[model samples]
Target chain A: MKRTEIRLAGEGGQGLILAGIILAEAAAVYDGANAVQTQSYGPESRGGASKAEVIISEDEIDYPKVNRPDILLVMSQLAHDKYIGDLRPGGTLIADTSNVTPRAPEGARVFELPLTDISVNTTGRAIAANIVALGALVAATGVVSKDAIEKAVAARVPAGTVEVNLRALNAGMEVVRRPATGSGDAH
Target chain B: MVGAGGVRLMQGNEACVEGALAAGLRFFAGYPITPSTEIAELLAERLPQVGGAFIQMEDELASMGAVVGASLAGLKAMTATSGPGFSLKQENIGFAALAEVPCVIVDVQRVGPSTGMPTSPAQGDVMQARWGTHGDHPTVAFTPWSVSETFSLTVTCFNVAEELRTPVILLLDEVIGHMREKVVLPPPEAVTVVDRKKPAVPPGEGYSAYDPGDGDIPPLAAFGDGYRFHVTGLLHDRSGFPTNDPEEAAYLLNRICEKVERRRARLTMIESRDVHGADVVVVAYGCTARPASRAVRMAREAGIRAGLVRLITLWPFPREDVARLTAGARRILVPEMNLGQIVHEVESAVAGRIPVVHLGKVGGVLMTPEEIFEAVKGV
Candidate 1:
């Protein structure tokens, strides 16, 4: 069975843990496959560094820890520096253009998206960046379906917050898919 | 014998999923912790296919609590967690002991007092499994060195849990949890599956779940069976009511401890290879057993006549069997992940006759084969 390993890293308040859980639930429950997700958090929950990894496979997965990440999504510069070395030699790297400023590592596909800006514009929220990044990850890897991710989000999040995160996810996916590359960069 | 079919390359944690499925485990509740998340994740997907239920509870405490609740309702239940999570479940585990609930708990132990190394291996929880919870209670703990053994031992855990009317712990560590190896599933009749004995008396006749009259253990009546009885953490009499009397307290506590301790002959299981004619014995368990096996090969190749003793069951300590095996040996080397847990037991058993040297490593790294061989040098 094919296995896809994805890592989400950011400052603690960005909800990287919840995003990874939704991504894994989408793969395991909705997609009818095996999914293993594990996370490591620092002492503080809000501003300290955090990271989570989700592995989806068609067959039974053996090792849960992702020694080498196939897709690395970093929302902050510290996360990029902390985990860029753990990415596989030829892998996909995605980052939030607003907060993460580190250039992508060589020998891998790189996509820069306005995740934070899109979250602010679409939902007027900064906390929904994780779902937005997850949306971009879904669009980029096609590992888990958009419908599955939405269902997982609806299953997990509060009723009032579901629609905002779904919209943020779609907005993030759309902004990254488009080729517009000028003043909106906000750098 | 285990058949070659259902053969596939699996890690120890994945094998635990297969073993639990084969043993008729229909419900699982767990939290996603390092070294043991695959069991929860695999069950989440597979349980639905098999008409079973899988729930990811709020934390390890809730995960174990939900499993106990599910077990009381007559479902075969289990929970998987690592060292820290296992620590959190201790009080509830003691509750299960007093309540006499039959369920399985898998502790894929990593190095830690508190999150020491999330992704490394350690056998530091050996003694904890025996006495982690408060007060004295009977525990049946199994340790598997290989991926396939992990599967078989999980089934064994369920079987013993039902047979003994208590919680059975499958104590594994990160090396076995993460190591990849091929496993073969046994045929139906080859592996023995034991279910809890039902009460001989009618439901209205007052059946006691904790009643062990003459035998080491008594049958447990599942809840909702129309059997009326009280369960409490305090020491209780034959009718299962709480008591403060010293005589009743001592009787209840000793009965609980001796029920398993008295059956040590049947309870203990070990694996010994080339140990009969050896001058030195290398005693190990869990992941250290793997390298110890390799060390035996290296020592034999170098004409050192070293033998290996691997423990399949860790608690109740397997004292008699260990003593028998080391009867004539000049020295015994005990290798484990922690500083000196199991070595203490071996030294006690050898009675200062055979020099019991310890080879250990902590904080998530495993002791190497060369280090073990060095410990056996003078023997």
Candidate 2:
């Protein structure tokens, strides 16, 4: 199988790092594929450009960073502005509509959804925005199976918050299943 | 014993803790630092459950000192830190080396001079790790690149330290320390654990702590085991007492280096990929090896004769194995996170036999595969 590079970029407190780990685990552990997850952030624990990258392939993965992401998930305007150009030609872009004004790249399938709003409406927790983003990513791109990601989320998230996080995840899938706002399937 | 035996996703730092525990690490004293703090955090929670001890020392100096003290009490002990903290521990690390205390010091390398970049990866500490502590000493530093290799290499670090009765270093970069991957963990019983040899003679029955007795390693007794023997940083004689005689000091120093240096056959480890007759061999360690390996594969795909030599054991400088592996290559390329640290070692090791190319990078950034492949293609 061809290698799939995914980049999740947002503020540090958005929990995107844990989301990346879960997504990689879904592919590598449950799906029985090779996946490597890496992240880079500022020294502070919050309010900086944070990114978590995952490379999934059928064979051994090398060159762990995501130079050109096949799928780019951006949660905030700063992340979207800095990383929108990094989306590969004919790649998939999933942006949070409420926070980002994405100028969709050419020949890309862009799904601009209200990710933070979905999390707040579904789970009554704003921190589940990352989980909602993951759900949208799996639903729109089909890179990782819903079943595998569900198992990963169940295994990785805190026990008490699992139900709310899963609710947020399914709500994310729901938005894509419905007609996404500003959705362009140019691919 | 931390969890049931199965395949799981883990980070390099967390895996180090599990490997140390499997290797019978019973006591840990460390100051938390970025890129290496996860080991201390996890060990703090897990050690007490296993009836082991964990202490967050006041500083890296105290942490290293405590590790030495604990190991002298006969428990397999360890301390971990990043480059800044690693510098502070050098004095005690040297003392442990001369005194022959069995302990493990883990340095998760970050860009350094004086905290050049916190939480960023760099391989700048290669020379410092080997010759960091004052004076001449043999170093056994294990550099593991991947998450799974981090586990096995950490186990080997403990075993080598215990068997040889010396301090061992587990060197890691920030990338490998923070990177997470799928690792199939082995059961606790499957791992081979080694304990330091103890004195055959009773405490008072003419037992000399530093006497090698025709062997390089003397059977050392724990401090409180009814055996009272001297251990000092000054040159010592066979009876463990400080000796002013030049011959006795030379004997002590020579034996200490020989004990570790002579075990090169057992201590050296490298992973060579497709270097039998390759034209260019890329030599790298720690986090840099990931891209180096990828570059080799890319070069091969592009019909270029490129290979990789991932040096696992960095200290005692595996020159022989390096020379042997890259003998067929026309040129050697070393890409380090530091500005030409390991490149010099390679240049000296090859000794102009193979034309060596140096590619050094800094600034808390990684050498991408494209850049490394370009270096290979340029040759």
Candidate 3:
């Protein structure tokens, strides 16, 4: 009867929807869990606040949309500000420090990482930041296995970009492995 | 029963296309509309690979016309559209209904009166699906709540349409149309397919296209299969020619309506959970059923007797099931994305035997489980 609700919020072109889909595919297809992915987008095609929500459960999922997310990943300042209030108490908040300034809510454990910088430096492209952030989120919370996420990433991304995306995913996990200082105490 | 093997993560729209292909759909004509464009896009890419044809018509009206034409030309044809496009397809849909052309029409519903929120989900077309086309034509509309059901029900739509020789509508709201979920598609061998019953009589052997012998449904003939027949939207006689004789016209119209109405019991599909001995029953369909199901679970945990009766086939509205499910209940709750479309059907079926409450949202936001739970608690 285990269920976890995760929200991935970012600008429209940040690939958050793809990240959510990959995470859902990893959980449902690879991990043998029931998962559903839903998304909301602002009017604009890009540069507008967009959010993708995934609900994973050991049992069949009845309600698909995430209300008070147990895990929230925000890639842009606007997304962080818009969705910060909706995270559950003691929820894990992962944000890209390169683009968003972390604002920890009550009982929220915030992990600030240079997600875009890591993707740009390690993968040589900032376009893989969503994958990088996904790696960090999976590392911070054992929602889905690393192996499953890697397989999902391989199946999802474009053919030629698989290498860089996998590198970006590992770089994201590396950020969480480095030190305890990357995450702030629950406020 | 679909075979239990091939599984994949798929969107509802994508699964619909796969289902259509499995059902022997060889021709598709549609105009791209929000939340429904994926169906056409996939069909455009996949139809050709299967040696089928896909046409992006100038508009929805033309798309429906093309679908009718394709079906007449011995192809299992389909067209997909959203709210505004659905409105435009109504006239031609009625044409298919009257002309007894077997075709599937997929309406991935979006919010609307006219050009409303293009991206938002709404079940506002419940009535439109049944009565959008003019006159008292019998309509068959299947609504699916999940991606897998979308696949199976799309196949069902084609089968029912082909068997009955009438247009069928697969009503899917935007949420189910766009939401991605895991689906294990049964192997193609396990799927059941039904093609339209062609005329048994030879071209010159007194072939009347509208003649069904003892049954209500007539055996349809392809346009160029040596079956010289006239097909028209106007009321026609047994020969398929337009008739001024009142008796022939009445007989034709009654037979068309009875073809579906007489088989209503078999056509209606419903799913009920924990309904027996429950004091409160929630009637829901499509994506709304997801939250209603959760709400029923929560209500049961909280020591409330709540049950769920989900409608899988909307049209030919399962009146008997509605009455049976709500007969002993103290209250019946109908929650839908529209303000109050299906609720009317529930009320009419219940007929004040129970207090039917309408929990509706027209603001394009899905009703959450918490909201439904609160409604259950209030009851």
DockQ of each: 0.03, 0.56, 0.52
RMSD of each: 9.0, 1.8, 2.2
Q: Residue by residue across B70-116, what tens digits does model 1's lDDT show?
A: 88877889999999999999988988877778899999988798987
Candidate with best DockQ:
2
Q: Ten-residue segment with the worst summed lDDT in candidate 1 chain B?
A: B1-10
Alpha-carbon runs more than 4 Å astray in model 1:
A1-187, B1-5
lDDT per residue as tens, model 2, B1-379: 1112465778999989999999999999999998799999999999999999999989889999999999999899999999999999999999988999999999999988897788788998899999999998878999998899999999999999998889999998889999998889887888999889999988899888899897999988998899988889888999888889999998888988999889998899988999988999999888889889888999999999888999999888899899999999999999998778888889889898888988889999888998899999887
How would you encode candidate 3's per-residue C-alpha lDDT over B1-379 as one tens digit per residue? 1112444678999999999999999999999989799999999999999999999999999999999999999999999999899999999999999999999999998889898888888999999999998997989999999999999999999999999999999999989998988889888999999998988888777777788887788888888888888889989988888999999999988988988989999999999999999999999999999999999999999999999999998989999989997788999999999889999989999887789999988978888999999999888
Candidate 2 CAPRI level? medium
Chain A of model 3 scored by TM-score: 0.94
Worst 10-residue lDDT window, candidate 3 chain B = B1-10
Off by over 4 Å in 2: A180-187, B1-5
The fraction of reference A/B contacts recovered in model 1 reads 0.00
* TM-score on alpha carbons, each prediction: 0.68, 0.97, 0.97
Candidate with better DockQ, 1 vs 2: 2
- How are the candidates ranked when ordered by TM-score, highest leading? 2, 3, 1
Off by over 4 Å in 3: A179-187, B1-5
Error of 1 at A80 (Å): 20
What TM-score describes the B chain of model 2?
0.98
